[model samples]
Every structure is written in structure tokens, then in C-alpha cells.
Target: MAEESRKIIHVDMDAFYASVEQLDNPELKGKPLAVGGGGARGVVAAASYEARKFGVHSAMSGQLARKKCPELIFVSPRFNRYREISHSIREIFFEYTDLVEPLSLDEAYLDVSQNKTGMPSATLLAREIRQRILKTTGLTASAGISVNKFLAKIASDVNKPNGQKTIPPEEVHDFLMQLEVRKFFGVGKVTAEKMYRLGIFTGADLHSKDEDFLTTHFGNSGAHYYKVVRGIHNSPVQPSRIPKSIGAERTFRENLSSEIFMLEKLEGIAEELEKRLGSKDRAGKTITLKIKYSDFQLQTRSHTGGHFVSKKAEILAIARELLYQQPLRESVRLLGISLSNLNTEQDSSAPAAEDVSVQLRFDF
Candidate 1:
């Protein structure tokens, strides 16, 4: 099928977890709140805007959050409630377009180029959707409208906390030229520092480099930087959710019964996990080790902490403890290591600024 212009919109709810708590309980509104525990070992899952003013944020230790905001209130996470609301929000997206790719419970990408309502203006569509979300859920959402996913995602951050931004078709070039490299979608702290060393401080600086130069310094990710700076992202919004966990598992044909042998296999599994995490520069505090016995009985052990770890050595050290935490009921047939609680829950990698030629105009 021949395609015309593309209109991608990224909608992100405002402090989804904390907001939901506030909606259900009127007392939590307009106060510094963290949706986790207030105990010394508690890890924060989310924070409200009031809490953000005091430097409290998600994934931080609850002890630190309390230190940052003395009056901050902490509540246990209600994941089932969150999932329920997230389902309702997705229903709203399906009403607009079928190309709904959920990044998490709080955000999604909508391809509205050919929408159900036949709206010609992506900007207006975003506004309408945000309004609908606010009316139905009693919560606010921010949206970004652009010709592709990359620009759309970044644009959404420009005006946040119940606001929206649009990068019109003709304005894409200038926007990229003026953007800071640090704000580019995939550029994390480590990548940004490396780019700075190469004297690439902004989109204009990144656009000046050739693919070869970037590839040499950054490996495969450099090619991504080169294309993104030139408004050339071509990845589409797939209709699925961002992965909840990333893992590597191995099945042994011989059903090893020895713990020593399991340790050897775990080292190799950890190596694969490091590669997966490094690919996206993601770090997480939660690690789970899955054990499948010869009899097909499955068991899982998990540990979560305040700091994030992405190295093989760090991951293997934890996996080793979980393996010896108890006696194996039977010979193990499969062993796996998975990491969750990632820092990049809201991060997405692709969305083209337009067709490669930039000839397609996003209709209004």
C-alpha cells in the first residue's frame, strides 16, 4: 500500500500512580506524595508533582525521599488499581487509531494519520484525546504531535503536566537544529558525555558528523545518533507494550542436578543479560532468577534494592545467592535471569520525523 503523511502522537499521563491515588483519596491531592513505602528498605515507585518540587522521584529510596521532603507521604503501590486505569486509558486510544503502542501503564504512541474520526489535524486530535482522558479519568495527560515518533515523543516533554506540544511538518528541521543533544530521545547520561568529548553538543553538532565517524566511536548506537540528528528516524509505532522484563534463559538437555554446574551455566546467562541491558543503557534494581526443574516445576526468586545494577558481575553475585537460598527440589532443566525495575520505563527509541525525503506533509 502506498503511504502518505504520518501523524504520530505520544500521550503520557501526569504522575500516573500518584495521580490515581489522589483521585481515589481526596486528602492526597495537592500534597507531596510518594507511591511506595516510607520504611528504610522501601523503594519509591512514583511521586506526585508536589513531591517533585522537593526533588523526590521514582526509583529513589523511600528513606531518601523522606529526607528530601520531610512531609512527604508514602503509600503502598496498588498495581491492580493502576492496571485497571491503564486499561481504560488504552480504550480511549483505540477509539482514535489502531496503532497504539503502549510504553507502560502511563504512556503510549498513537498513529493517527488515518484516524477513526477522520480528523485532519493531529494537534487537535491530541487536544481532544487529552480532554477525553481528563474528563473520563479525572486525571491530566500531556501529548506531543509530530510527523513521526521521535519528534512526537520529544515534543510531548516540551510542555508537560497537563499540556501538549506539536512540531508541525515544516518546523521539523529547525526544531532539530536547535535541540540539545542531551534531550535527544536515546541519548542517555553516558552517551551524552561521549558525544560531548567528540564536540557534539547539539543536534547541529551531531548532524555534522558522518555515519562512519559516529559508528567508530559509539559502535552501533552511533549510527542511530547520526540518523536522529538529521530528522531521519523511520521506526514505526508497533501496537504492543514495552517489554516488562528482559532476560536470557538456557535449557540443559541433561538436567543438571548439581549446584556447581548450575553456577557455571548462570555465568554465561549473566553475560547475555549484560549485553541486553547495555544495548539500551538500562539499569534496574530488581533481578529475578527462574528455575525450572526436571519435573517441569517452576520457581522464581527475586530481590530489589535502592540502586540499579547493569554489570554481569553484579547480576551474577545476586543470582548466586538466590540459587543457594534453598535446596533444589529436583534436577533443574532450565535456568533464566531477568531484570525488571528498569530506569527507562518511559524511554522509546524510534519515530521518524517524516518519510526519509521529508516530502510528506502531515495534513494540518
Candidate 2:
């Protein structure tokens, strides 16, 4: 028998944190608002549509955001409340389809080709799901329906808040061919510039390049570019996607030049890492150390162990080696550590903890 055609829907909440705040507080409606920490080093976590008009966006520094929109009201994020609402929304999704893949607390992809309601139209199902989310959580969501994940995800962004878009399989090729190269999933600013120089500015241009040409120019990613331009993405909506890495990072108020001070800061970061690992009961074989210089140059060093390391001593041992092996080029402003190649399976034995109170007596 021939295989069944796929139906994927990507659901994204509209400015989730800001919308939740507006729903809970009547006065915040129709005003420009941002949910974030408000300080010298603070960053915006979410921005309302009204705020977005002035070029405010997430990950932008609060200082610059204020400069862009002086009236932007900043509110601290209520993570617990957001999580509660996200749980309610997920329950609604499961009512329609068990094949749900959560991208974050406020977004997910659902395979609704074979749904609980036995509905044959994925577009109608998307509308129903959006309406249910609004009715249940008092917050609106946007949706995109397509034959695969990539197109569906992009479609969700077409009609802003509280809207849905569906791309029939028959229209997929035309839709992609007319789309801009910069709009493709993995294409960023640098890649777009390279494409422009190579005279590949649109999806049609990307499609025109042969597999060998793309591969020779872009390495492995060229293959992905070649396939996606033709609407050939087949990656599934995985329901059990585990996190590949966990990390903690901090930006200092003052750049430090002393190796002694940097090591002290790294020790605090390692302790936090241990606590996080213990909470998740996860260990990883790879340890990475990241640093940002005062001039904004970034550098990283990593080492992979034979076995997983989650305990404080084990993490610090590898982290310390990575730090000392590289000499500082300038004053450092940011530092971070991460663990990857994780072991998420339940381990029968408990991780042993040890204290290593070594002072920074040596200098590079």
C-alpha cells in the first residue's frame, strides 16, 4: 500500500509572556509592554506587538529597547504562571492528537493527519485548536498547517496574532520558489550575504544550484539548503526530543583581567552546574568553557571524557584544565560552562560529591 500523506501543524502563542500579563491585568491591554529584567545588563524576554512596532524584540538589551521605545513598560517574567498556562494548552492539544512535539513552553508541532476527532482537514483542526486554546487559557494562538514541519513553522508566522495559514501540498513548490532566500529556515545574515554574492537571492536561485555546487560551496549544510528549497523536508515531528546540552552563563558588571578572580567566578558557575545536573539527574561526556573578551571577541574550549561527568569536582577538574590551557588575550566580560553528549537515562547509582577548595595561587 502507498504511504499516507503527512499533516503537520505548528502552533505559536502570540507574545506569550506579554499576552498573559495583559490578560491578567485589564489596564495593560493595547499598550506597549515587555517582560524582562529592567537594569543596566537586563534583556527583553518577550515583547508585545505594540512594542515590536518600535523595533523592540526578545534578546535585545533593555537599555537599547528603552532607547527604541521610551514608553515600553517592562515587567518581570512570571515563569510559574506561564508554565501553568502552557500545561493547560498542552492538554488541549492532546485532546486532538497524541503526536505532539513541544518546541518551548508556548509553541509546539502536532501531527494531526490521524486525529482523535477523525477530522480529515488539518486546516479546520488548526482553527479548532486555536479556538480551544483561547477559550481555555484566555490567550490567543496562531497556527500553520502544511505537509511537513519546516513549511508549517514558517506558515504560522504569516498571519500575526490569532490567525492561521495552510499550505496545500499542491501549492508548496510555488510558495517556496517565490520566498526570499533570507526567509529560509537555516539562512542567517552571513549566509544570506554569501548567497547574494553568489547571485542566489531567492528560493528559485537556491533551487537552481546543483547538489554538487551547493555541497562544494556550503559543505554539509549545502545539502540541507538544496533539499529545503525544493520543499523536500522530511524530518519528523519527534515527541520525545531530549535536550542535548545544559549550561549556565553570567556577564560581569566589570571586566576582569586577573586570572585569580576569573577562577573564583568559574567555581561559582561549577557549583550551579552541579545543582542543575542533580536536579535533572543527567551527566554528560563533553565539557565546554566559553569566554567573551572586553572587546566583544568570543572564544571557547572543550574536552570530551570517556565517561559522563556531573559531580562538582569532575566538572571543575575539566573546566579548570580548559581555562588554564588557553591564555587570556584581553580583559574578559562574560564566562560560561556547558555539558553536552548527555546521559539522560536513569542511573541506579547516586553521583558522589566532593569538595576541592584549591586557591588560584598560579598565574598564566
Candidate 3:
């Protein structure tokens, strides 16, 4: 299949966790709300649009969120309910195309170049998918339609929270050229600042740099930047996504200065991690311990053994070893445990070779 002929759509649920909370309880619908892992020390997992109006958002500390939106309501996360809803959403995606690559519980990329419904236009498919998802889940979704994933993903955010955007093949070049560098998917705060320092503030500026100069500054990702700026991202939509690691973490109500308190928290985190591994029927040789200090400084220590550990005792033991391996830099507020290099990591079986022929004239 030619790159220009591909039709990709990125479907993103609007404020998914907060929306679910709003759906389950009528009182939270119109109020400023933050769905959190827990209250007090926990970070905002998701913020309702009402909360966002006051500059509240996910990963904002609860303390700050409260200051920003004094009337904000904090609710505990319900993973089981979120997963049940996510499964239903995935079912909706599979109804249209098998080439769905889920980025998380709330967003996914789909290749409907050859759709199950024989729909010639990808824009209509996106509208119908969003409509179906709303009818089925009572939740709204936004979509982006384009020739490839990169354009589609960015487009999804342009008109958000129940809106959709399309960037057809012909307009992709100009669309990318005028785009701000900060709007690029992987360009976070640090990267955006660096790009600013380098005078690469827009796609046009990025396209002005050679691959060598980009590689010199951005390492391996420079090559990727060089490709995406010209609307040249060609990575296929991988349906068989693999988990790189599995982990669980918890935030404490107060920062603990004692290692004993840290160890006690590790036990519970390990127990949650053990259940997660069991659910996936997975175990790995690598165990990592993550720490967040009172000042929000984050650190991680990892150890990989020859043997894999799936049980609670073994996981807790390794986590304990990692905890003691380094002295506390500061009073800690968060702890986590994770496993990687799983048994599921094996030689890649090739994705099915296929062909696609779609109408190149997409109406964005």
C-alpha cells in the first residue's frame, strides 16, 4: 500500500475518567471535578472540563489543584469500571477495523483503509464511530482523520471534547508547516524549550534542519523528527501491541522520613503488582523501585535477575533489596514496583503482509 492511500483515525475519549465519574453520579456532572488515585497526597489522574476551566489538569498535585479550583471535587479512581468501559469501546473499534492500536484506556489509532463496513470515506467512519461510542457508553469522543497516524493524532486535538478534525492528503504539507513545535506529540516542556533555544519553533523551522544536525542535538529521535515534520510519518498501525512492562504505585498522605514506613508501603504496592502479573499470566526478571520525594523529585532503581518472579514474597523481597540499595535522598511521598523482560518477550512473528487501495481524495 502506498503511504498516501492510508486512512488512519485517532479516537480519543473526552476526559474519560472524569466523564465516567460524572456519568455514574449526577452531582458531579456540571461541577469542577478531579478523578484521582486517592485524595490528599495523590496526583490528579484526570480532570473534568469544568475543573480545566480553572487550569486544573492531570498530574497536578492535589494541593495545587485545590488552590486553583477551591470548589474542586476529588473522587477516587475506579479501575474496574474504567476497564469495563474501555473493553466496550474496543469492541466498537473492532466492529469497523481489526487494525486498532490502543495507546491507553482512552485513546487509540485505527487503520480503516480497508474497513469491515466497506466505507470509502474515512471521515464518515470517524463520525459514525464517535456516534456509536456515545450511544453505547453515554460518553463523547473526538477523532482525527488523515493519511497516516502522526497527522491523525495531532488533528484529534485541534477541535477537542466532542469535535473532530481531518487533514486530507493534499493539505498535509501546509498543515504541518504552520504547526507549532510544541504541538508535536513527543515535544514536552523540556524538548520544546530545547527546540526554542535551537530556533526551531515550528514545523517549517524543523524542516529547515538537516537530519545530521537534528541527530546531533536530539540523538535517535532526531531522525524521527526529520521525518514527521514534512508529513512523512509512515509507521504502520500495529494491531498486536505488546506490554513492555507492568507496574503499580501509590502516593502517601504525607511524606515519610522513615525507611520502615517506605518498606511497609512497598509491601502493598508489590501485592497489587503481583495480582496484576497474575491477571496477565506474566513475570519478568527485572524489578524496579520508583520513589518520589516531598519536593516531587523522582528516582528509580532496578535489578534484573536470571530468574523471573511472579509471587508476592519474591517481588517484595527484590523491592526491599532495591530500597536498601540506595539511601533516601529526601523524605519520600510515592513508591512503585514494576516487572519487565517478561516471558512474553519473544522473537517477532511478522505482521500479516497486506495491501490497501483507498480513495486518495479525502475531504478534511
Task: Give the CA lDDT, 0 to 100, for residue 339 in model 2.
Answer: 98
TM-score of each: 0.72, 0.87, 0.86
Best by lDDT: 3
Mind sharing the TM-score for model 1?
0.72
- Report RMSD for candidate 2: 11.3
Considering TM-score, where higher is better, how would the candidates rank from best to worst?
2, 3, 1
Candidate 1 lDDT (Cα, 0 to 1): 0.89
Over 3-46, each residue of candidate 2 has an lDDT whose tens digit, in order, gives 33788899999999999999999899999999996677677999
Once superposed on the true structure, which residue ranges of model 1 sit more than 4 Å away at CA? 1-4, 241-336, 339-355
Task: Go through the candidates in order and give each one's C-alpha lDDT.
Answer: 0.89, 0.88, 0.90
Q: Listing every candidate in turn, what is its Cα RMSD in Å to the true structure after a full C-alpha superposition? A: 11.4, 11.3, 3.5
Error of 3 at 294 (Å): 1.6
Candidate 2 residues lying further than 4 Å off, grouped into runs, are: 1-4, 253-257, 292-299, 324-333, 344-364
Q: After superposition on all CA atoms, how large is the RMSD of candidate 3?
A: 3.5
For model 1, residues 186-234, the per-residue Cα lDDT tens digits are 8998899988998999888988899999999989998788777777677
Residue 240 alpha-carbon offset, candidate 3, angstroms: 3.3
- At residue 200, candidate 1 shows an lDDT of 90
Go through the candidates in order and give the clash count of each.
Answer: 3, 0, 0
